[model samples]
Target chain A: MNFAQPVYYPKADYIETDTGNKVSRRATIAGPQNIILGGKTIISSTAIIRGDLRRTGPGHAVVISLGKYCLISEGCILRPPYKTYRGNFNYYPMKIGDHVHIGANTVVEAAMIGNYVEIGKNCIIGKFTMIKDCAKIADNTVIPPNTVVPALVLFSGSPGQFVENLPESTQELFESQTKQYYNRFQPLEG
Target chain B: MAPIKDRFTIHSKAVVCQDVDLRGEITIGSGTVVHPKATIFAITGPIVIGANCIIEEAVIIINRKKEVMRIGDENLFEIGCRVECPSIGDFNTISTRARVHYTLRLTSYCVIGAGCLVVLPEEEVLEEHTVIYGPASERRVWSGRGHIQELDLRRKHSEYLRETLPKFNRLRRGDGA
Candidate 1:
């Protein structure tokens, strides 16, 4: 929480037009100065993005960057992984690709998340973990640090074991469904 | 001192941010950092916190209808976690958004996973180095010590917050350099 006491936001909420990004006022985004978002993204209430934890050394490093058509649900924390290098512990940058939907209460500290991925609720994606494109992580999945998840595979359980291959229609389905959600995420027009 | 005013006493070397909502007798231990917007309400009795603990933002720690609440040293209460536990042992990692309710005694080196709902029964007793996690509520007991690396991360985070957060929020007392 910042120093400024949060006032009452509009009941209906806010949405960006050009990028089509919808961010809830209740979301705690630390260092909004460093975050970059692509078009048509939805960040729900209670989502936390820790951009304040940046690299140790100087130079303007991008903390977190998201691609188009992403949805971050409630109580999710998006933070970069930290590691000690040359006697200095630094937090590297984190990048996410397009059409990703991260479900509620998920703690993500991954280095890179690929496109068309869907992560379910209450999952923990550990630091420096790289997720390839079109993966589906089931609910309560725990992917350990430095782990790599391949594309188009369904994964579950602790330590995130692969379960099954996704359907052929997965890409089309996610694209269309996320578009629908973005269109339907209105706060009830007055 | 009046009874209502005597309940709130902040000890030395405790850094509580100006934005915190504290009600009743809450004793903050030395080297502990309570971040901004952390709401801690003591309804039953006094709440005592040990040293070197970090309480992050939006964390609601309430002692409702209970006798006393005591938190241990070197513990990390992550963001958005709702805790109503009575006695918490040292070095426990209560992760993000995890709800711990009515815990009698949590042994040391226990790692409660993120988003886990831990409601301990009166008869249940948590062993040391117990990792409680998953939506299915799996319990994994270990004989060895806890993850010192994970605890170290919190210290690093607290150090970072100590350097950075005061630039944004108004800090109350002595904490980090």
Candidate 2:
């Protein structure tokens, strides 16, 4: 319930797409055609979305598919996971569900992140990590590679372990928070 | 803002994305892959990155000291990591969100784990096979014997990036040989 104040950004800095995606002009999005943003997504300044890292030997695969009301804060890097399988290197596609909020300076190399997930500032979601719905990761947490986080849990600390079960109301709270954040992000008044 | 003088000498075989902000004099060796949004700022001196290095997205390599910064071959700078060190030897891996302060000089086969900060009081050179990790910045020396597998993996990874990245992303045009 942080109804404190609305944050205003310079209108010149962001490009509001047809689907209401407010992407900063400074954000470097590689391979825009391979990324699908559902809508109302805010990609702040210096955030990099690596959609060019698609699967090899593929016929036009989608690299990063993000759902509605997602927020990629400043200095965040979102790159798809890759691995050597059967003596061949391959990059996997990353999927993020709705109302997901990734904080500032976070580097996410996850395979999948489910709905209503809130990842805190400076966190590193490791390679091929899968996060279930309504999961929350605290600031400076480093989730290990191939770790699977269960639903409705709070993950904290380096080599992030499940600290506690989140309240059942987490989904509703996260949804509202994301929606409010999107609404409150307005252009500076003249 | 004043215009930045771009003095970059990228090898023809290297894959440096067009979106990378390369300022001052920098030399990228053959088989190196510099991903988009990676920043290489040589403020005080030149930076020479060796062959088969992988500089992932948002990685920042800054040379703020007077001496030249020389990074050796087969290095991997993972996403969002910051390197301000003056010298880094071959086969080092600086993982995600890690910070290598200007005071530390890394020798060959060092691994700075994710989110770790290497900030010594003054200039210190780390020995080979040093692995600095965790929130507490614990230090350990990995046995160099029987560890050829990691370097092999890195070589394969960089080779894959050098081949596939140009097919998807627009590469920065190399000035000269």
Candidate 3:
């Protein structure tokens, strides 16, 4: 891993919120009011968070709730899953736990992603899929709709079957890696 | 190089986000919901999209040929999909990160699966209800009857977005009716 290399971005391209969430200017974040971001999350350029697809009718609703120290990489699209209930179509909120690292160009439509999960590049997480804690989804994996990925396993391939069990220390490893990635993502000094 | 003319005709009921990148001549029919960061580049032709289409974020539709590129109603272009096809019929779903090359013509009820790349020979046409999916880019004919439920769901999705998106994001006006 290129963990030691510090990735520098232009300071003008990002807006750093008070909660230490770094959101890129080029990222298309629709309905910022409906998105709840925990502290120290990094939303890279070209990442699209569709918070506007909230639940229909009456009162306000939270569309996407992301936890702390998450890394949404470049070109990643995060859209909440939607389905028809009682003959009326509605969108459900997406919940993502802490220390989750979503790789570049991955389109995630999952209902929930648990803590310390690492999803690799170019993966398509289908609608309403549930990924539990400490799971590792390999690059280019296409998970089918309504699939449940249990904890501590590595999922790969087009249909995204379980490949093998992950190490017990995966949670610690992912937490440290995500924290390190957030720290190393800095702007070049003048 | 000559400056390209910007001519867009969007219906008043269409909800196009302000951040969408549109160039050259384009016509968007009513009830189309174009999300932010979607790009429609008509470099050498006029592109016409029919009613109730959902153009999701980061979708790039480029028309480089001299002939007009037309797209029918109730089509769903999901996030990060690229389409350079000549013409497309109704009720098509192009899933996330799929690429349809310029030489193909797509018909109604065709489902292009996620991450699939359709790069057929020149002037090739995709038949109706053709489902292209999997890592090997498998092709199959869907034996089910007309996708009435799916199309109805798509229409509902588009309607919901049209009603909800403008409430949260800035709309691009003055280019459409």
Best by TM-score: 3
* Per-residue lDDT of candidate 3, residues B29-139 (tens digit): 989999989999999999999999999988999998989999999899998899999999998999988999998899988999988988877688999999999887899
In model 3, the runs with Cα more than 4 Å from the true position are A1-5, B174-177
Q: What fraction of the correct interface contacts does each predicted structure contain?
A: 0.08, 0.64, 0.80
Cα misplacement distance, residue A3 of candidate 3 (Å): 9.4
How much is the lDDT of residue B170 in candidate 1? 65
TM-score of chain B of 2: 0.95
Best-to-worst DockQ order: 3, 2, 1
Q: Check candidate 3 and list the clashing pairs.
A: B10-B176
lDDT at A65 for candidate 3?
Answer: 96
- Rank the models by lDDT, top first: 3, 2, 1
Q: For candidate 2, lDDT tens digit of each residue in B1-97?
A: 4444668899988899987888888999989999887899998788999999999887899998878899999999998799998999999999988
lDDT of 1 by residue, A80-155 (tens): 8877665455788999999999999888999999999999998889889999998999998878779999988999
Task: Report lDDT (Cα) of residue B167, candidate 3.
Answer: 87
Off by over 4 Å in 2: A1-5, A187-190, B1-6, B144-146
